[model samples]
Target: MINRYGPYKRYKQVFGVTSHSNPDKEHTVVITDKGEWQCSCPAWIFHTPRKPCKHIQEAMKDQVVQAFTPKPITPKVEKVLNRFAAIEV
Candidate 1:
Protein backbone atom coordinates (compact mmCIF):
# COMPACT_ATOMS: atom_id res chain seq x y z
CA MET A 1 0.00 0.00 0.00
CA ILE A 2 1.26 3.47 -0.82
CA ASN A 3 1.10 6.31 1.71
CA ARG A 4 -1.01 9.35 0.81
CA TYR A 5 0.78 11.34 3.45
CA GLY A 6 4.23 10.58 2.03
CA PRO A 7 6.62 13.59 1.62
CA TYR A 8 4.35 15.41 4.07
CA LYS A 9 4.67 12.57 6.58
CA ARG A 10 7.10 14.55 8.75
CA TYR A 11 4.59 17.38 8.94
CA LYS A 12 1.20 16.73 10.52
CA GLN A 13 -1.27 18.36 8.14
CA VAL A 14 -1.13 16.73 4.74
CA PHE A 15 -1.64 13.41 3.01
CA GLY A 16 -1.01 12.06 -0.53
CA VAL A 17 -2.28 9.25 -2.73
CA THR A 18 -0.53 7.05 -5.24
CA SER A 19 -2.11 5.56 -8.34
CA HIS A 20 -3.06 1.93 -7.92
CA SER A 21 -1.74 1.21 -11.39
CA ASN A 22 0.36 4.28 -12.19
CA PRO A 23 -2.56 5.93 -14.02
CA ASP A 24 -3.66 3.60 -16.75
CA LYS A 25 -6.61 3.31 -19.08
CA GLU A 26 -8.66 1.58 -16.39
CA HIS A 27 -7.88 3.27 -13.06
CA THR A 28 -7.14 6.66 -11.52
CA VAL A 29 -6.83 8.01 -7.99
CA VAL A 30 -5.83 11.15 -6.14
CA ILE A 31 -4.69 11.66 -2.55
CA THR A 32 -6.41 14.59 -0.85
CA ASP A 33 -6.91 16.08 2.59
CA LYS A 34 -10.49 14.90 2.52
CA GLY A 35 -8.90 11.45 2.43
CA GLU A 36 -7.46 9.04 -0.09
CA TRP A 37 -9.89 9.46 -2.96
CA GLN A 38 -10.38 8.24 -6.50
CA CYS A 39 -10.35 9.98 -9.81
CA SER A 40 -12.48 8.65 -12.65
CA CYS A 41 -9.40 7.60 -14.63
CA PRO A 42 -9.77 8.47 -18.30
CA ALA A 43 -13.26 9.64 -17.52
CA TRP A 44 -11.64 12.42 -15.47
CA ILE A 45 -9.98 13.73 -18.59
CA PHE A 46 -13.38 13.76 -20.27
CA HIS A 47 -14.83 15.65 -17.28
CA THR A 48 -17.36 13.76 -15.19
CA PRO A 49 -18.50 13.77 -11.56
CA ARG A 50 -15.22 12.34 -10.30
CA LYS A 51 -15.46 10.14 -7.25
CA PRO A 52 -13.04 8.29 -5.01
CA CYS A 53 -11.52 5.48 -7.04
CA LYS A 54 -10.02 2.15 -5.97
CA HIS A 55 -6.48 3.45 -5.51
CA ILE A 56 -7.83 5.61 -2.66
CA GLN A 57 -9.35 2.50 -1.16
CA GLU A 58 -5.95 0.82 -0.94
CA ALA A 59 -4.21 3.85 0.56
CA MET A 60 -7.00 4.33 3.10
CA LYS A 61 -6.33 0.87 4.40
CA ASP A 62 -2.83 2.01 5.34
CA GLN A 63 -3.94 5.35 6.75
CA VAL A 64 -3.32 5.99 10.44
CA VAL A 65 -6.47 7.69 11.69
CA GLN A 66 -5.25 9.82 14.58
CA ALA A 67 -7.43 9.58 17.66
CA PHE A 68 -5.98 12.40 19.74
CA THR A 69 -9.16 14.44 19.38
CA PRO A 70 -9.33 17.46 21.66
CA LYS A 71 -12.42 18.96 23.22
CA PRO A 72 -12.86 22.69 23.76
CA ILE A 73 -12.85 24.11 27.32
CA THR A 74 -13.43 27.59 28.65
CA PRO A 75 -10.97 29.41 30.95
CA LYS A 76 -13.81 31.00 32.95
CA VAL A 77 -15.21 27.61 33.80
CA GLU A 78 -11.81 26.39 34.92
CA LYS A 79 -11.37 29.39 37.18
CA VAL A 80 -14.72 28.72 38.83
CA LEU A 81 -13.74 25.14 39.48
CA ASN A 82 -10.48 26.21 41.08
CA ARG A 83 -12.26 28.67 43.37
CA PHE A 84 -14.77 26.05 44.47
CA ALA A 85 -11.96 23.67 45.39
CA ALA A 86 -10.27 26.36 47.48
CA ILE A 87 -13.42 26.91 49.60
CA GLU A 88 -12.76 25.04 52.85
CA VAL A 89 -15.60 25.08 55.40
Candidate 2:
Protein backbone atom coordinates (compact mmCIF):
# COMPACT_ATOMS: atom_id res chain seq x y z
CA MET A 1 0.00 0.00 0.00
CA ILE A 2 1.08 3.58 -0.61
CA ASN A 3 0.08 7.06 0.43
CA ARG A 4 0.86 10.21 -1.51
CA TYR A 5 1.50 13.70 -0.23
CA GLY A 6 2.05 15.02 -3.75
CA PRO A 7 5.36 16.28 -5.06
CA TYR A 8 6.92 19.49 -3.77
CA LYS A 9 9.85 21.37 -5.18
CA ARG A 10 13.00 20.78 -3.16
CA TYR A 11 15.47 22.69 -5.31
CA LYS A 12 16.27 23.40 -8.93
CA GLN A 13 15.50 20.23 -10.90
CA VAL A 14 14.55 18.32 -7.75
CA PHE A 15 11.25 17.29 -6.19
CA GLY A 16 10.17 15.37 -3.08
CA VAL A 17 7.13 13.95 -1.34
CA THR A 18 6.13 12.14 1.80
CA SER A 19 4.44 8.75 1.75
CA HIS A 20 3.77 5.69 3.86
CA SER A 21 1.27 2.90 4.12
CA ASN A 22 1.25 2.94 7.88
CA PRO A 23 0.10 6.08 9.58
CA ASP A 24 2.82 5.75 12.19
CA LYS A 25 5.76 6.05 9.84
CA GLU A 26 6.38 8.09 6.76
CA HIS A 27 9.11 8.00 4.16
CA THR A 28 10.49 10.58 1.82
CA VAL A 29 10.33 10.14 -1.92
CA VAL A 30 12.84 12.18 -3.85
CA ILE A 31 13.19 12.91 -7.53
CA THR A 32 16.79 13.81 -8.23
CA ASP A 33 18.15 16.59 -10.40
CA LYS A 34 18.95 14.00 -13.04
CA GLY A 35 15.29 12.90 -13.14
CA GLU A 36 15.95 9.73 -11.13
CA TRP A 37 13.48 8.76 -8.41
CA GLN A 38 14.29 7.38 -4.97
CA CYS A 39 12.50 6.49 -1.75
CA SER A 40 13.62 6.17 1.83
CA CYS A 41 11.58 3.12 2.70
CA PRO A 42 12.47 -0.34 3.91
CA ALA A 43 10.90 -1.95 0.88
CA TRP A 44 13.02 0.19 -1.36
CA ILE A 45 16.11 -0.25 0.79
CA PHE A 46 16.00 -4.01 1.38
CA HIS A 47 13.79 -5.27 -1.43
CA THR A 48 12.88 -4.46 -5.04
CA PRO A 49 16.53 -4.01 -5.99
CA ARG A 50 16.45 -0.37 -7.02
CA LYS A 51 12.98 -0.54 -8.55
CA PRO A 52 10.70 2.45 -8.17
CA CYS A 53 8.55 2.19 -5.07
CA LYS A 54 4.89 3.09 -4.84
CA HIS A 55 5.82 6.39 -3.27
CA ILE A 56 8.17 7.25 -6.08
CA GLN A 57 5.62 6.03 -8.61
CA GLU A 58 2.92 8.22 -7.15
CA ALA A 59 5.18 11.23 -7.06
CA MET A 60 6.23 10.80 -10.68
CA LYS A 61 2.89 9.74 -12.13
CA ASP A 62 2.65 12.71 -14.44
CA GLN A 63 6.24 12.31 -15.56
CA VAL A 64 5.70 8.60 -16.25
CA VAL A 65 2.63 9.36 -18.33
CA GLN A 66 4.40 11.98 -20.34
CA ALA A 67 7.39 9.69 -20.90
CA PHE A 68 5.26 6.78 -22.13
CA THR A 69 2.83 8.80 -24.20
CA PRO A 70 4.00 9.10 -27.78
CA LYS A 71 4.05 12.44 -29.54
CA PRO A 72 2.63 13.05 -33.03
CA ILE A 73 5.24 12.82 -35.71
CA THR A 74 5.09 15.26 -38.60
CA PRO A 75 5.78 13.79 -42.04
CA LYS A 76 8.47 15.48 -44.07
CA VAL A 77 7.87 16.20 -47.73
CA GLU A 78 10.75 15.74 -50.18
CA LYS A 79 11.36 18.57 -52.65
CA VAL A 80 12.03 17.50 -56.22
CA LEU A 81 15.17 18.89 -57.84
CA ASN A 82 16.18 18.96 -61.55
CA ARG A 83 18.72 16.19 -62.25
CA PHE A 84 20.06 17.92 -65.43
CA ALA A 85 20.85 21.29 -63.81
CA ALA A 86 24.29 22.61 -64.78
CA ILE A 87 26.86 22.84 -61.95
CA GLU A 88 27.96 26.40 -60.97
CA VAL A 89 31.63 27.09 -61.87
- Candidate 2, 30-86: lDDT as tens digits: 554456665556676656447887766766674443333222221210010111012
lDDT for each of the candidates? 0.36, 0.42
Index of the highest-TM-score prediction: 2
Model 1 TM:
0.31
Model 1 Cα lDDT, one tens digit per residue, 1-89: 33232222222222233454554222323333444343333433333455444544554564556543322323432333234223312
Q: What is the C-alpha RMSD of each candidate to the true structure, in Å?
A: 19.1, 20.9
Give the lDDT of residue 38 in candidate 1: 36
lDDT, residue 73, candidate 1: 28
What candidate 2 gets wrong by more than 4 Å, as runs, is 1-20, 62-89
In terms of lDDT, the poorest run of 10 residues in model 1 is 6-15
Which ten residues in a row are the worst by lDDT in model 2?
76-85
